[model samples]
Target: MTEAEYIKEAKKGSSAAQKWLFDELSGRMLMVCRRYVRNEQDAEELMLDGFCKFYSSLSGLQYQGSAALFSWVKRIMINECLMFLRKKHTFVIVSEHVAETLALQEDILDNLSAAEIFNLVIQLPAGYRTVFNLYVIEGMNHGEIAALLGISEGTSKSQLSKAKSLLQKMLLQQNIEYGKRKTQQ
Candidate 1:
């Protein structure tokens, strides 16, 4: 069935249409959740909750297209991740943007796999990771991030700078670790 058709059925409470959405979008949504939530189990739980919200709101939700739908779902998953993070973590304000924005060598990035980069990001503190993901990956401006996270734009910039600093540290550690593993092998 077409996506519009599926939405119509899902609005009418058709289980099959709902299942199709779950089966199709869960993997992508799970990855979105996982990027913020460090653990797989929690990410999966968030993805499920996000799906539930989307399913229930289908009747009133406007569809701009598949890309828009994905965007909507992703925002839902991000919110769930943030909710989990807020509960699990004590929000710390790192006033100084001590994490210097370093332009790492392209050669280094070329050597590291995407999974390695993701793992390094996962290693960052919750605040740093969220701001980094929002600013860098999600392409959100500091102003948008401030509004979203309820902080000043300066705080958003500081968090992002700190995140960049931490990511660099993590990347360096990963490089060292990889070198050691390679020697061992």
Candidate 2:
């Protein structure tokens, strides 16, 4: 079915369309939630909350395009992840300041699968991982991340830095050492 048709049915509260949308998007949205949340059950719960909000607000939402719908749902999922973190008092952790810069190997990530990269991200502390996902992956600026996390912009920056450092350390620990291949002369 076309996106417009699906949207029309969903706006009218058709359970079938809603269920179809849920089945289609739930896995990807759950992965998005997992970026900020550590536990699988919590991530699933967060994704469900996002779907609940998405359906409840569908009537009022303007569907621009298929991509827009996905982005809208993703934003909802990210918000749900933040809510879960806030409820657990996880976001309140003081941001760490790591003076050392990270030298992450470029090709190492090239070799790792998306799941591998995601695993590395999930290993970060809650605050760092949230800030990292929001700033780096979600493409939100520090100001936006600060607003979402109720923190100063500096804190968001610090958290991203720490997250990167931690991720780099993790990569090295996993034997993914930093090295840029030198071109042969």
Candidate 3:
């Protein structure tokens, strides 16, 4: 069935359509949750929560296209992750001065694979990881991120800067370690 048909049936409480939709989108949605949350079980739970919200609100959603459906679901998943983070009070806002002191080498990211980069991003402290995911991956501006996270725009920027710097350092360290291993082999 087409996505529109599936959405329409799912909205009308068709269990088969709902299952199909869940099967189709769950993996991508779980990955989105995992990006914001470090814990595997937590990410899976948040993804399920996001799907529950999406299904409950399906009647209100205007069926656009597959892209719109994907985007809407992704937004739901992101919001769920953000809410979880907020409840944990995990956003550790460092002073802008301290974040500014770290210099990011842009070229370091170019050498890493997408999976490698994602692993590095998840390793960041909660504040830095959240801002980095919002600004870089989600293409949100600092102001939008600040409003969503209830932080200042400067703080959002600082967190992103610090996240980048830390990623660069991690990438460099990985490269150095790889070189050492290569030489010893």
Candidate 4:
């Protein structure tokens, strides 16, 4: 059945259709949750919660296309992760004066796989990770992020700047380590 069919049936309380949708989207949604949350178990739990919310709200969703469906589900998953982070009081925003932005070498990024980049992002602290994900990955502006996270725009910008600086340093260190290993071999 097409996605539209599944969504229509799922909305009508079809358990089989719901199961199919869950199986189709769970992996991607889980990864979305993982971007904001570092803990494996917590990410999984948030993903499940996101799915439950999505299923419950299926009645009101207008199924535009597969892309729209995925985007809506992804947004739900991101919200769940953000709420979890907020409840933990994990956003440690530093002052704007101390914010340092570093230029990341495009060449270095070009050499790394998506998974490698994701791993590097996952290593960032909670505040940096949340702001970075919101601005970079989710394509949200500083103002939107600030409003969503209940922080000032300056704080949002600072977090993103710090995230980038830290990522650049980590990338450089990884390159240096790789060069050393290659020389030894």
Is candidate 1 or 3 superior in lDDT?
A: 3
Off by over 4 Å in 4: 106-111
Return the clash pairs for model 2, or none: none
Q: What order do candidates take by lDDT, descending?
A: 4, 3, 2, 1
Worst 10 residues of 3 by lDDT: 100-109
lDDT of 3 by residue, 1-185 (tens): 79999999999999999999999999989889999999999999999999999999999999999999999999999999999999999999987887764667656667778788789999999999999999988999999999999999989988998898888788778889999999999
**Residues 1-185 of candidate 4: C-alpha lDDT, one tens digit per residue:** 89999999999999999999999999988888888999999999999999999999999999999999999999999999999999999989799999987766657756788789789999999999999999987899999999999999999999999998999999889989999999999
Cα-based lDDT at residue 59, candidate 2: 91
Candidate 2 differs from the real structure by a C-alpha RMSD in angstroms, to one decimal, of: 4.5
Show pairs that collide, candidate 1. Answer: none
The per-model lDDT (C-alpha) reads 0.81, 0.83, 0.92, 0.92
lDDT, model 4, position 11? 99
Clashes of each: 0, 0, 0, 0
Give the backbone clash total of model 4: 0
Q: Write the per-residue lDDT of candidate 1 for residues 61-141, one digit (tens) a residue.
A: 776798998898899899888888778873557775554566545466457676776777787777888988898779899
When superposed on Cα atoms, how far off is each prediction in RMSD? Answer: 2.5, 4.5, 1.4, 1.1
Native RMSD of candidate 4 (Å): 1.1
TM-score of each prediction: 0.85, 0.87, 0.94, 0.96
